[model samples]
Target: MSNDNAAPSSSSAAANGSADSAAPRRNSKRPKYSKFTQQELPACKPILTPGWVISAFLLVSVIFVPIGVASLFASRDVVEVVDRYETACIPAQNRTNKVAYIQSSANKICVRTLTVPKRMKAPIYIYYELDNFYQNHRRYVKSRNDMQLRSNSSQDDTSNCKPEDLINGTAIVPCGLIAWSLFNDTYSFSRGNESLNVNKKDISWKSDRDHKFGDNVFPKNFQSGGLKGGGSLNESKPRAGGSHCVDENCSSTNFQKVVWEDRGGSQQR
Candidate 1:
C-alpha cells in the first residue's frame, strides 16, 4: 500500500510540473506609448475670455494706429507721375484730315498737369511708373545660369538656359533670361518745355557683376557683336518719337511734360 501511494504522489508531482511549464507567465513591466499616440499625451488648452479679447484688440489698435498714420503721411508726401504713352500715341497714318481726327491726334499726347494742392515739405521724392512689361515671365526668368554667375564657369547642366546657354563648348557670359531680353526702353523728361536731365549711370542693380565677361571673353562677344554668325542677340529696338537728353540740368518750372513715346518716361519732383 505504501509503495502504491508513493508512486501516485510522484505521478501527481510530474503532472503539476507539466501544467506549470505549459501555462504562460504574466509580465510585470507596462508597455510604452507609441510615437504616433505620444502627441495625445500632452494636454494644454487655452480659454479666451471677453476681457482678454478686448485687451488684445486694444493693444493691436494702439500699435497699428501710429504705423497707419505714418504710412499715410509718407504716401501723401510722395508724388508719383505715370505716363502711359505706349497706348496713348496714335499713329500719324491713322489720322484723317477731318477736324475730329486732328483733335483726336492732339489728345494722343500724354500730358499730366500737376498742381501741388498743399505745400509739401522740401525734398519731395518723385517716381515714374511703367506697366504692361513682364520681367518675371518663364522664358525671361530662366534664361540665366546661376553656376556661371557664382562659379565663373558654365554649368554642366544647362537645363535652365537650354540651347542658348552653350555654344561651341563655351558658356555665354551673363547667361540668363534677363540678359537675353534686356530692357532697351529709353526715356526723356522735361519740366515746362525745358528738357530735364536723366542720370542713367548706376541705374542698374549692383548685383549684376561686370566680371561676367570672364578672362576668356572679349567685349565684342556681347549683343553688339556677332556670336556664332548670329547678328545680334537682342532684337528689341528702342521705341521712336522720344528725345533722350542725358546728364542735363533743367530750370524749376511746373507744367505738363508730354511723354510721346512708349519708353518709361521721366519724372520731376
Candidate 2:
C-alpha cells in the first residue's frame, strides 16, 4: 500500500534536513592561516634538534667553566673573622649568676688582642652578634609613639609608650622600650698607639633625618633617674626654637649595625 515515489521523497528530505542542521564550519581553537595572522607570517623557524641543543650547551659550558673556576680561586682569598667574646669577657665565678653581675654597677670590661695573618681590605664591616636575644618581642616592640618622636607638636602624644612614656607628668620625646633600651656597651678601635677616628655620620638612614623625625623635635625627659635603661642620651643641650642640632641618638648599635672596621684583627670588650 506504500508508494515507492513517496518513500524516495521522504528519504531525500531526511538527508537534506541532516545536511542543513550543521553547515561546514572551521574549528575556533585551531589557528587560521590568514595573510595578516602570525600563523601565516614569514619567519625563521630554527629547529633545535638534539645535535643543535648539545652543541649550544657545550659552547656555554666552555665559556663559563674557566670563568667560574677563576672566580672560585679569587673568592678563596677573602676570609671572615668571627671572634667569640662572651666567654673571654665574663668572669669565671660570676658565670653561674651572669644576670646579677651584668645588672649590678660592677666594672665589666675585658680586652682581647689578635695578630692578623693577612691584610684586611678597606670598607670592612664591624657588627655585634648577640646570642639568646629576642629583638622582635611583642611587648618590647609595640612600646613606642611615632608621633611623639617625629614632631615637636606631638611631644605629649604618648599613647603607645606606656610605663616609660611619662615621667611624673611630662612625656618622653623618644618614648619607647626600644629607645629606652639603647646600647650601653661601647666599642672603640685603636691601631698601635693612634686611635682610629670614627665616622658616625652615616650611622642612621638619611630618610630618618629627613622624614621620620622632624628637625624641630628634640629630647625632653629621656632618663629621669627612675631606672637607667641602657645608653645615655645627650639631653644637656637646650632646644632654641628652631631646627638646631637636636640631641637624640637613634642608632641601632646592638640590634642592627654595620660599622666601618679599624685596620686590626683584635676585638676588645
Best by TM-score: 2
lDDT of 1 by residue, 1-269 (tens): 99999999999999999999999998867658686556766567878999999999999999999999999998987654445544334456654444354334254444544555667565445545546656556775666555554342343435576536655665555444444444333445576889856543323222332332122221112343233221222212211111231222211110111111111233333
lDDT of 2 by residue, 1-269 (tens): 46978998999999999998878876699676787776566879999999999999999999999999999999987766777877678899988988777778888877777566678887566655656655577887788777765678988998878778888788886687766765566767777897866544344444555556555566778867568776655544322222233325333321111111111112222
TM-score of 2: 0.62
Alpha-carbon lDDT, every model: 0.44, 0.63
Q: Which RMSD values do the candidates have, in order?
A: 12.1, 8.2
Q: What clash count goes with each model?
A: 5, 0
Model 1 score (lDDT): 0.44
- Lowest lDDT sum, 10 consecutive residues, model 2, at 255-264
Task: Tell me the deviation in Å of residue 135 in model 2.
Answer: 2.4
Model 2 lDDT at residue 56: 99
